[model samples]
Target chain A: MIIANTLADGFVVFLTEAHSWTNDITKGAVAETDEQAESLLTAAKQAEQTNVVIDPYLIPINIEDGLRKPTEYREYIRATGPTVPIPS
Target chain B: MYRYDEFDARLVTERVEQFRRQAQRRLSGELTEDQFKPLRLMNGLYLQLHAYMMRINIPYGALSSKQMRQLAHIARTYDKGYGHFTTRQNIQYNWIQLKNVPDALADLAAVEMHGIQSSGNCIRNTTSDQYAGVARDELEDPRVYCEIIRQWSTLHPEFSFLPRKFKIAVTGSPNDRAAVKLHDIGLRMHQNEQGKTGFEVIVGGGQGRTPFVGKTIRDWLAPEHLLSYLEAILRVYNLDGRRDNKYKARIKILVHQIGTDEFRRLVDTEWQQIKDGALNLPQSEIDRINAYFTPPAYAQIDDETESLNEQRTQNPAFDAWVQANLAEHKVSGYSIVNISLKSPKLPPGDVTAVQMDALADLADEYSFSELRVNHRQNLVLADVPQKDLLSLWTKLIELDLATPNIGLISDIIACPGLDYCALANARSIPLAQEIHQRFQDIDKVHDIGELTINISGCMNACGHHHVGHIGILGVDKRGKEFYQFTLGGSSDQNASLGDRTGKGFPADEAVNAVEKILNTYIMVRNDGERFLETYRRVGMKPFKEALYGSA
Candidate 1:
């Protein structure tokens, strides 16, 4: 799965729904194969041109119970956001 | 306290205008990321893990209450209502909008501040002793020289691009609070045989993947020739420093490759040309900048040490705070109050907008209208009167900042880690929070005594883990978070690097590993001995044995 932060305000973004960036990963497509992941990255690279998200890249992940999750702890933190509140 | 002149004002305004245009261009796709990266970096706007992190340079870590209020305003208006004070004496807003940066910088400029040259491959904001003028042990106020260097290095046409970013730190006292020895260029003020103040010029000291304590390039450089000498060193570095690899681009690599003696010869050769040339700082300009940093109008008040002692005896919390946080001021009646940003739960160095406003108010009411940002990511109310210590402590308590864990084990130094930084390999903040939580009792923490536990998300050393007595560097093993510990590091006058523990602990065992080391210290330490002192005396054998459990 390709995960990134939006350039405008820095929220979590996932490549979802035909290569569009969205916050919801459940609605997103996961790479079924390495070839598909490569193709997804090629499609996602265009998001930088739109200047919406910066440095989009693939991460190790596991999909279970129809929900996607990052395989790594750092990726999990980035995907879910900081454990602490934003302090309003 | 050095107010911007008309030229400075004009320069800041023009830079803001230019960055505004560049921001617009980037948004509209007129500029690509490759073209726009340097421009944005020069303005201190960075794309971090979650958002755009805008680093605001607080020159010499000096800020007036008005400037602090402006920072609070910017945090409230443009960012996530708080800012993280960095280890380099700057505050970073982690959640900034790319479009809002120009406006935020415009607000900063209204307070005579700009982010120029803060993040680019240029000389960054010249950091110095937080208690520059007021330290009892100071030979000179390093801020005067800091301002001099700031003016000399700011927007220098020749140094706009270099091999990599350069950092300089200066100190005026024998007690090295500024960690001057761990910078690209470090200047330590001292008196020569004739009782004239100059600097012991040290170069090539840095902490990163390759860590080295700066070597003394010049034993004594005359005060008048400061700028010329610095320009000479930089000129040599600019021409000769490596550029082939980004990892090896720092001037430290150059100094290491050529050796300090050869590097000194080159700097000296360059210096002879500019020694009496236009770069020689004029006496009037030096005096003009120095005048801004003279001792504030101190009242004829007694030290009141007896009463402060009495108050400490009465209130245990205040006493713990007084013991840990307060430093003796040059003026007898005043005390340097170090406000700890390392609360037990929150991330170290994070301060909220409301807290900033409150600190500004505290500065105005208790201390003078000035508060200093220490390079340890704490704030200093430098001139608080001895009599007002209790009241200040009370106020801090109300603000949830009176943790009284200043030099204690709980007062951790951790970077933003994977939570915020794009470059981090593993999580640092969560590890730090775990450590802080593990060691919570103030009495127990105080008994542990004066252990600097620094954690960096990666080997970049943003958390200054290289100099920590107990340094923790987070690492990744097959996408799993692990931590590596180091021992016997000190950033004081006796600057030294830490030695790695030879093993890595998975995230679950990281805090337990630290606990084992600390337990070993408690077991083997002499009376009133700090962790570093014990580690230095005994060497690492016992601690290694404790962690790894024998051969």
Candidate 2:
């Protein structure tokens, strides 16, 4: 999966199947093969060039129990909010 | 407490407008992320793991009541309802939006504060002792020198783009509460044989992947020579410090590579050329800056010991707070009250907008309308009258600001880890929260006695974990989270990096490891020995035995 922070607000977003960015990781476009990953990253880069997002890159993910989950904990944190409760 | 003059005001206002334009351009697709990153960083805006984080400078850890109120407003208006007070004596808003940052900078500028120099490779916010003028043992107020450096280093074209970010800290007292030995440059004020005060200039001390206790370069430098000597040192680092590898780019690395003696020789050679130049401060200029920090008018009064004892006898919790949070003031009737932001209910150093406002009000009412942010991630009400202890304690309790965990086991200094930082390897906040929750019994915490547990999500050492009595660094073992523990670190007058225990503990077992270490300390400690002192006495033998089973 390709992910980025939106250029306007710097909020974490995932590249969607529609070549657009969504804040929800579940809605993010996934790739199974290296070629698919490269194409997805290329599309994310296009989004970056168009100023829809900033610093786009690929992140590993798995379809666990029919839910999209990031492979790395850091990436998982990026997809969700902070693991700990923030002060209100 | 230095008020902004016309030039300072104008500089900040102009910078805010410039940043406003830059942020607008970035949003409008007129600038790429590559182009906008540096500009945003210069304004102290960072794109972190979750959202944009903005760092705001608190010059020498000092804030007026008005400034504090403005910060509260900024927190309520531009960000999530809270702000994190950092170890550098700065405040960071974790949930800031890039679009909101320009306005936030404008808001900060209204009160003579800015995010400039809070990030970037320039001289970052110059930190100083929280009890600068009020400490009983201080030779001179360090904030005067801090203000001078702040003015000189702001947008300093010569040293803006150095090998890496540089930090400078000053301590007015010999006690070294500012952690002088762990900064890029540390200035320790002391009297010479002639009773004249000057600074002992220490250079190349920092903590990260590499930690070094600063070595003194000049034993006694006259006050006038401070700026010139600093310029000379910075020039040496700028010209010769490594720029190839980011890891090996700090002045500490350079000083280690080419010995400190050689680095001092180069600095002295450069100093000879510029020592008598315009950078040399005049006594009049020093006095001019010093006037801004003049002691507030204090009334002649007794120390209120009888009344304080009466109150202490009545409320045990307030007594615990008084015992833990109060530091002696130079003045007879005044006490330096530390308001611990490390309540287990919230993340360490995190303060809500409501809390900020209430604390500002408390500062105004009890402390001459002034507050100081300490490097230990606590707020100091520097001038609370001794007689007002009970009243202040009651208010703090009402506000949930009376945590009485200063210098105790639960008083953890932690950085925003994988939760917010882009460079983090594992989560620090949750670990800190867990450890803090495990030790919430104030009686047990006080029994632990002056132990510091610092957590950093990565090796950047933003949490000062290298100098923690028990340092916990979060690391990733493959894809799982693990923590590396280091023991016996101190960032005091005698600063030393902690020794690492063998291997890393899995996240679930990390707290159990801490419990066992504490148990071992309790078993072997002598009377009146601090955790660090006990550790130093026993060496790592006992700890290693307890932790890794004698090998």
Candidate 3:
């Protein structure tokens, strides 16, 4: 599991294969199988390896194109949609 | 004490006009908050939690009575009739309006002061001992070199946009009152075996998430090469210090990651390139700056022992203050008087406009129209006569500025915290106030003896809680305030970061926990042992057990 910390807005998100989680227990998604969740965890770890922690307040966010942007305003990012769109 | 040359004067005047236009543009909706944020910060105006804050520079912590009175005027007219002096020896007005800041800068400039280089990523204020020139043990005045650095660093075109903020502290005496070891560049004046004055340069000392005591980079750097050497270090930092990650951007991390030897080699290589450039100090220029700080024409008088003794016998309150707050001056019959800003009811370093004017009058009457803003957030009249001590004490008493808490627990150093700081997670002033009230007993504080209790509202460590004898850090736990205590930090010759004791305490119980820690120290301390000494001898085991109960 990887946690993303945000500053301008408060709260950290825990990311797992099936879904993103906030506040530890609040789940965001459900994968069809546990194997898919494991692959997601591996991808998150790989993303974390390349990410740079600029301000401690920012959290690493993963885009569908396999790039990560550290940002505090996740809502703005969500509104704009990902730079790399996911496969429909 | 650096007199502004025409170039310096013109630069500040132009800066003031620029900021005036920026403010006007922001008000007229020509500039958005995103556009104006960096511009305002470049000019030392910050939008904090409650109001706009303007930081005014006191270069090398030195101030004249005229400059101080101008500060008083600003406090009276523009702010909430008060100002807070910071650990960097700069004064901050917390309630300033955006419209009023340009005028505030202009007011500051009239007294040969400004807020330039006070914020932003450029080199900030160069601080030094408040007793720089007047201290008995000083090799030479550190302010001369500080002024030299200030002139060179102010808006140096190439080095303005560094990775992180840089701080430099200089001290002339071996006592290290300026806390040089905790600065990005710590310059200490020393006389080598040959009896020549030079600086012992230390680099990479800083506090934050990662606190490291600076390592000595040069054993003896000649006074003439001060600017060249500093420029080399700054240039190296600007190019190599991490810009990718702000957390790893301070020169401290650079020094740590590259290792001191490599960092030193880089600086040496860079210095060789710029050694004899325009930055090299000319002998005539050094002498000119030194002349402004020449010793006053002091009259030879006896130590005024009889009068001092008489006053001590008659007035115990004045006697206690004298013992705690006064320092021996280099001149006979003269002493340095600390006008305490740590009254119980007031914020730790807050001084009202009326009090500032009174202090200005006192400085003129007592100390050759000069004053100093100390890093510990107190004001100093550096040349008060021993005979005039009683009169000054009486006046200070009337003004409610005569708290005899210098170097004591009540003389706590605290940041504005969540009460006023935008970055703060919890409040620090209320905790400081609570601790001050808890240890209000003068005799008890005297018995506790020479403790520095520093509190920071956040991990930025502006209050330097990491180096406090008893450091209190405020953290937010589920939206409620929690306090973490650390023990045995000292910034003097034996510089050491404090050790965390254990689990954090809630806000209401922190004062009692501190009381327990002090009580334990009092019980375990040997004779003549200070608080840091006892904490060092027994370690935090005894303190933790005392505060949290034996387990």
Candidate 4:
């Protein structure tokens, strides 16, 4: 799956089936095979031209029980907000 | 705080208009990301992991109450209702949208603050001792020259773009709270044999992938030759610093590869040409800048204090805050108050808008409507009257800013880490939180006394892990979070970099090492000795032994 953030306001997003960015990773489009992931990336790269989302890139994730989850701790944090609640 | 002059004011306003257009162009797709990246960085707008981050330079760390209140307003209105006071003596709003930053910059400029030179490969903010004017042991107020440098470096045609970013820090005191030796250019004020005040210029020092203590380029430089000499050194670096590799582009790398002696000779050769040129500042200009920093008229205060002493006896908590956070003021009956941002729950250096507003109010009531951002990720009410210390402490406690862990073990200095920074390899805040929880007893922490534990998320060393008495650098080892420890580092005038323990601990077990080390210190320390003193006297051998157990 590929991850990106909306350039308009930095909302966490995942590239979906319609080549659109969504907040839900479960709804994230699966580009399984290497060729498919490459082809999907080609579509994701076009989002940068629209200037809607910034720096769309791939994140290594596993399909764990019907949910897409990041393989690394750091990337998981990028998917969510901070691990701790920020000050009020 | 130094007020902007007509020239300064005009320049900032014009720059704001320029950036507003540029941001609009980028949004309208007139400028591509590649083209706009440098432009945005030059304006202190960074595309961090989460959102656009804006760095606002608080020149020499001084802020008038009015300017600080303006910052609070910005935080509440445009940002995430908070600002992060950085180790560079600047404030960063981490959640800025691209559209809001132009307005944010304009807000900052209205109060004589701007983000210009706060980012990009430029001479960044010139940080100074937070207690610059009020330091009892200070030989001269460093901010006088700090303001002078701020003017000289702002929008300089010659140094608008260098091989890499440059930093300069100034200190007037012998105690070196400014961490001068860690800057690209560190200037320590001193007196010559004739008792003429000048500077001890240390050049080519920085922290990032490579960290080194700056070498003293000139033993002493006369005040008149300051700007000329600095221009010469910068010119040499601009001409010689590597551009091929960003990692090796800093002046520190150039100084190392060519040797400081050779670099000094080259700079001096350039200096000889410009020594008495237009850049040589006249005392008239120096005096004008000095006039801005003249001490506020303080009321006649008693040399010996009774009220504060009685308060200390009556309230132990207030006394603890006084003992841990207050510094000796040059004025006999004044105290420099340090308001710690390292609370038990919040992130270090994070101050909310409400907290900022409260601080502004507190400053008005007690500190002559002035405050300073300390390099240790804290705030300073630099001129609080000794008699008002208790009152200020009470107010601070209500605001949750009264963390009595100033230089103690719980006073951890940490970077935003993986939480906010795009460059971080591991999370720093969680580890810092764990340690703060582990060392929860204030009495024990105060007893541990004056131990600095700095944490960095990566080798960039934004947390200054290299100079911590005990350092924790978070590392990602084969996809798992691990922390590497270092010992015997000090950021004092007598500075020393920490030695790595050659040990790594799991994320949760990192606090175990700290506990064992503190316990060891408790057994071995001599009376009246701080952590670094005991570490220096005993050496890292004992610490290594205590931490890892004979291997």
Winning candidate number (TM-score): 2
Looking at model 4, give its docking quality level.
Answer: medium
Quote the lDDT for B529 in model 4.
Answer: 87
* lDDT over C-alpha atoms for residue B453 of model 2: 98
TM-score of each: 0.97, 0.98, 0.86, 0.98
lDDT of 1 at B64: 98
For residue B146, model 1's alpha carbon misses the true position, in angstroms, by 0.4
Candidate 3: residue B177 lDDT (0-100)? 93
Residue-level lDDT of model 2, residues B87-111, one tens digit each, is 9999999888888888889989999
Which stretches of model 1 miss by more than 4 angstroms?
A33-39
The weakest ten consecutive residues by lDDT in model 2 chain B span: B439-448
Per-model chain B TM-scores are 0.99, 0.99, 0.99, 0.98
In candidate 2, residue B237 scores what lDDT?
A: 96
Ranking of candidates on DockQ, top first: 2, 4, 1, 3
Candidate 2 global TM-score? 0.98
Error of 2 at B369 (Å): 1.0
Predicted model with the maximum lDDT? 2
Candidate 4 C-alpha lDDT tens digits along B300-409: 88744677778889999988998899899999888899999999879999999999998999989998899999899999999988878877888889999999988888
TM-score of 1: 0.97
Query: Which ten-residue region of model 1 chain B has the weakest summed lDDT?
Result: B403-412
Candidate with better DockQ, 3 vs 4: 4
Runs off by more than 4 Å, candidate 3: A1-88
